[model samples]
Target: MTFLQALWHYPFLQIVMLAGLASAVASGVVGPLVVSRRLAFMAGGIAHSVLGGLGIAHWLGAPPLLGALLAAVASALLIAFASLRIRENEDMLIGALWAVGMAVGIIALAQAPGYSVNLMSYLLGSLLMATRDQVMLMLGLNALMLGLLWLSYRPLAATLFDPEFAALRGVPTGLLYACFLIVVALAVVVLVHTVGLVMVMALVTLPAATARLGTARLPAMMLAACGAALLAVSVGLATAYAGDLPAGATIVLCAALLYLAGLLIRHLMERRRRRSA
Candidate 1:
C-alpha cells in the first residue's frame, strides 16, 4: 500500500506522524541556537539531566512533561550560571551537572515503587503510545517555541554572532541568553516524549548540522534544517513501521545518513569550485 493509504488506515500511524512532525518542528527551531552557541555539549547535558525530572514526576504522580520542563529549565540556568564562573572548564562543569542529574533521577526512580516501567518508556521513547492529548500538547509547545524564535530573531541573531557587539548596540544580551535557555528547556520537554533523553540531541543537531553544510546564511540554514528534520522523521517513521525497528533510533539513524549525504554534497561543491577556479 502507498504511504498515504497506510496512514489513512491506521490511527496509530496518524498519531506517529503528528508526533514526528511536532518533534521535527521543535528540534529544528531550537537547533540553530544550540549550534551557533557552541552549546551542543551543554544541550546534551540538559537532555540527560531531564531524567531527574522524570523521576520526580513519577514519585509525585504529576505529568512527567511538567517535571521534565521544570528540571530542564533549572538545569539550563545552572549551566548558564556555571559557565560564567568556570569559563575555562565549562564542559567539565556541564559534565558534572549531567552526572549529578542522572544520579538523582535514578535514585528517585528506585525510591518510587512501580516506576521502573515508566522509566523505561522515558529512556527509550514510545511515540506509538502518544495519545491525542499528548499530540496536542506537543503541537502547542512547538507553536510557542517557534513564535518566540520569530519574535526574537534579530536580537537572537546578534547575540549568537557576538554578544559583546550585540550589547554595545543596546540589545540585552544577558536577557536574550536567558530566554534562549528557557526555549531550549521547552524544546527538550517536547523532545523527551518522542525521542527520549538519550537520543534527543540527535534529533536537534543532525538536521541543523546537515543544513549548515549547504548554507552559511542563518535563515537558509534554519529553513534547510526544518526541511531535513521533517524528511528524516517521516522517512524514519515509515521505515520503523515497515521493518519493526524502534522509532526513535530509526529517526536518528535516518538523520545521520542524511547528514552524511549532505557532507558528500558539500565536498563535491567545494571540489567543483576549486576546479573552476
Candidate 2:
C-alpha cells in the first residue's frame, strides 16, 4: 500500500504524523533562539544527558519519558547556573555532563536483568511506533511551550540579540536565559521519543539554521523554519514508509539536505546582488 493509504488506514501512522508535527512546531519555535545564542552544543549535551534518566527509569520499571524529563531539566539547570558563574569552562562542563550522563545511564540499564531494553529505539527512533498517548502528550507540551514563548517573546528576543542591553533595560536577562534553558530541556525530552536523543540536536537546529540563510528577522525566520521542518518531516516520513527505512534518521537527512539547499540558494542570491551592485 502507498504511504497515503497506510496513513489513512492505520491509527499508529496517524499518531506518528501528529507527533512529528508537534515536534516540528516546538523545534521551529525555539530553534532560532538556539542558533542565535549559540546554544546548539549545550542543547546536545542536555539531550544526551537524558540517557541517564532513561536508564534509571528503565531499571525502576517506570516511564522512560519521565526519567528523560527529569534528567534533561536537571542538566539544563546545572549548565545554565555554571555558565552564569563560570563562563570560562562552560563547554568543559557540558562535555563532562554529557559523558557522565551517558555512562550513568548505561550502568543503570545494565543492572536491570531479564528485561531487554530496546536501546535502538531510544537511540534511533521509529516514529512509526509512536502511540496515541505520546502524540497527545506532545501536543500538550507543545501548547505549554508556545504559551511560555509567546509571553516572553520580547524579553527573550532582547536577551538573544543583546543580553547586556536587555539587562540594563531591566529585562532580567540572567533569569530569562535560565528559563530558556529549561524550555530547551523540555523540548528535547518531548522530542526524544520522536527523533531519539542521538539526532535531536539536528531536528531542533537545522530548520532554524536553514531559515537564517534567507532571513535576518527572528519572527520571519521562525515561520520559515517551521515550514522547512514541516516539509522535512512530511517528506521524510513518506520516504521512510516507502523505503522501509529508519524514520528519525531519514528526517535528519532530509533536514540536512534542506540546509545544503538553503546554503546554495543564499550563495546564488549573494552573487546576484553583487552583480547588480
The number of clashing residue pairs in model 1 is 0
**What TM-score does candidate 2 get on C-alpha atoms?**
0.95
Cα lDDT tens digits for candidate 1, 1-277: 7667899998978988998889888888788778867778878888889998888887788877778888989988876676554553678877986898788888888898662656667887888788888888888888888887888989988987888999999998767776787788888888888878888888889999998888778888888888999999899888888888888888899999999999998889999999999
Give the per-residue lDDT digits (tens) of candidate 2, residues 12-31: 88888998898888888888
Report every candidate's CA lDDT.
Answer: 0.83, 0.88
Where is the poorest 10-residue window by lDDT in model 1? 79-88
- How far off is residue 49 in model 2, in Å? 0.2
In the predicted model 1, the residue pairs found to clash are none
